[model samples]
Target: MKIIQNFTDYHEKTPLALSIGMFDGVHLGHQSIIRKLNAISEKKNLESAVLTFWPHPRTIFNPNDDLKLLNTLDEKTYLLQKNGIRHLFLKEFDEAFRNLNGEEFVRQILVKKLNVKHLIVGYDHTFGKNKSGDFSLLRKMSDECGFKVEQVEAVDFHEKHISSTQIRNALAVGNVKEANEMLGYIYSVSGKVIDGKKIGRTIGYPTANISSDPLKLLPKKGAYIVEVFVKNRKYKGMLSIGTNPTVNGNSLSTEVYILDFNEDIYGEEISVNFRDFLHEEIKFENIEKLIERLDEDKKLTDNFIF
Candidate 1:
């Protein structure tokens, strides 16, 4: 997919069938809109396009909150590409852009910049100046502006609507199964393997410490069964997201122990896909107890694989 970083960079000849949102996690609900977008794009012979924001609007309004996002730019790009979008307009959200009203956003970004011939949005979607736009406003604008607009209804799972916020809440509680079910895929994070205290080596577990994006949301602090990807290979593993309380550490860390494998992966890039929540991180009474718990973890992880 072609990524258009700025409004000036947009130069598409074919008018676009577009959707706009943060698309955080690009969960099932977002996918419903995307699927409709692609169908309409193909049927109407327009370019499939998406206009997503960066740094999130919430991050801007609540600067002190350090609001975490579900997908990084790179991850979002890949997911959108897989969903069959042709053009991705990644607009930077700032105070000035936030000031645009619903009509202004339709005129400027949708009509002027993207030349959007068709627009698809989620059921609860809102845009422009305090989110004053909804399907009603969009339909009225479409009638006046000479473009087409569609609102895809929410995708309901087990009587609850699938949404990004719901998925984030699930992960926050270490409910990977629910999150992944709503996401329609494994929820994963990518980061650089950094040097740690080398404490795992002495215990014979030798973990690869991960330095993930600060803006990216992390799962609840606990042990988990995970799939690790490194050097273009996938491996089963157990991951920990918590402070090393047994070692008198107070800072939270993310590290994974690759099953039946050991190598120098420091400074390498790795991805971890959470599969199942294992146990809450425990502060063992002694080193021996910690080692014993780790052994049990390894067995459970191994059995999970087999």
Candidate 2:
């Protein structure tokens, strides 16, 4: 996909079938809109484009709130490109950009800048300052602007709409199975392997310490069944997320012990996909007790089907 960073000097001669949103997790609901865009673009022979904002609007509006995101910028970009997006337009949501009203945004950015022939938006999508723009406003202006507006109805899972916020809520409490069902893909975290206390090795279960992006939202502190991707190979593993209380550790950490695998993978980048929540972090009475729990975790992981 051709990524247009901001509406700086780029211009598309061909009319675009466009959709605009932050598309945070690019969850099922977001995908439905994109799929509609793809269908419309193919039918009308228009260029398919997704106009998204960077630095998340929440970050700019609510600076004090430490908001954790489901997917990083790179992850969102990859998902958009992989799922048949032809153009990805990124608008930096700074103070100056935030001041644009509904009419101004449509005229300056969509109609004039992108030459959007048709706009595909979600049912509850709103834009402009204070989110004053809505389907009614867009429909009213579509005639003069020489464009059409189509709204995708809410995509629901088990009666509730599948949303980024819902997915985040699921992850916050370590409900990865529910989150993945809503996401249409496994929830994963990617990072570089870092050195640790090597405590697992002492107990016959060596682990890879993953140091992920601080902005990445990690599942709740606990043990989980995971699929670890290392050097393009997949392995079943049990991941522990917590401070090692039995060892008097203070800082929280993520460590994954790959079953039946032994290798020095320090410094390599790896991705871990959470499958199921095993148990909450426990304060074992001693190292022997901790080892016993580790054995149970491994047994459960072995039986965990992908």
Candidate 3:
């Protein structure tokens, strides 16, 4: 997909059938909207596009809160492209953008600038200054501007609405199995592998330490059975997320130990997909005790693997 960083960068000759939102997780609900967008684009022979904000509007408005992102920009782009979106406009949500009023945004940006042929939005989507724009306002603007507006209802699973917030909550509680069920895929963390104190190596379980995106939402601190992807190969692994209490507990880290594997992965980019939470991280009495528990973790992980 062609990724346009700003609305001004949109120079496509074809008018766009667009979906607008901060499609954080690209969860089932978001996918439903995107599917509708694709159908509209196909029917109209227009480009399928998405408009999303960077740094998330929430991160800007609430800077002090721990802003955890479900997907990084790269990850979001990949998911959108996989779902048939041909263009993406990733706008930087800054002070100037915060000032655009609802009508001004619709008239100047969506209509005059993007030449949006049709718009697909989530049922509860709101936009413009102070989030004053809603489906009603969008419909009004679309009617005046000669464009169509489509609102997709929230997707539900067993009476629960599927949302990024819900997915994050599940992961925060170490419910990877349930989180994956909602996400329609395994919950993954992608990052570059970095150097770490060779403590795991000393204990015969050499690990590849990964540096997570600062803005990415992390699952709860615990050990988990996971699949590690490096060099396009997926390997069974045990991942740990915690501040090692047994060893001072000064710094928190996410480290993966590939089962029966030994290879230098420093500087390599990898993604780890959490399959299930193994156990809570705890302080062991000694190295021997830690090794014993790790051994048990390995056996437990093996049983859970497909």
Per TM-score, the best of the predicted structures is 2
Put down candidate 2 lDDT per residue, 154-234, tens digits, no spaces: 999989999999999999899999999999999999999999999889989999999998888999999999999999999
Best by lDDT: 2
Ranking by lDDT: 2, 1, 3
- Tell me how far the alpha carbon of residue 221 in candidate 2 is from the true structure, in angstroms, after superposition: 0.7
Q: Write down the lDDT that model 3 would get.
A: 0.88
- Greater-TM-score candidate between 1 and 3: 1
Q: Whose TM-score is higher: candidate 2's or candidate 3's?
A: 2
lDDT of 3 by residue, 84-201 (tens): 9998889998888889988888988888888998999897888899778889998887877989998899899768889999999999999998888888878899898998887999
Worst 10 residues of 3 by lDDT: 5-14
| Residue pairs clashing, model 3 | none
Flag regions of model 2 displaced more than 4 Å. none
lDDT winner, 1 or 3: 1
C-alpha TM-score for every candidate: 0.97, 0.98, 0.96
Backbone clashes in model 1: 0
Candidates in order: C-alpha RMSD to true structure: 1.3, 0.9, 1.3
Backbone Cα, N, C clashes tallied per candidate: 0, 0, 0
Candidates sorted by TM-score, descending order? 2, 1, 3
**Per-residue lDDT of 189 in model 3:** 97
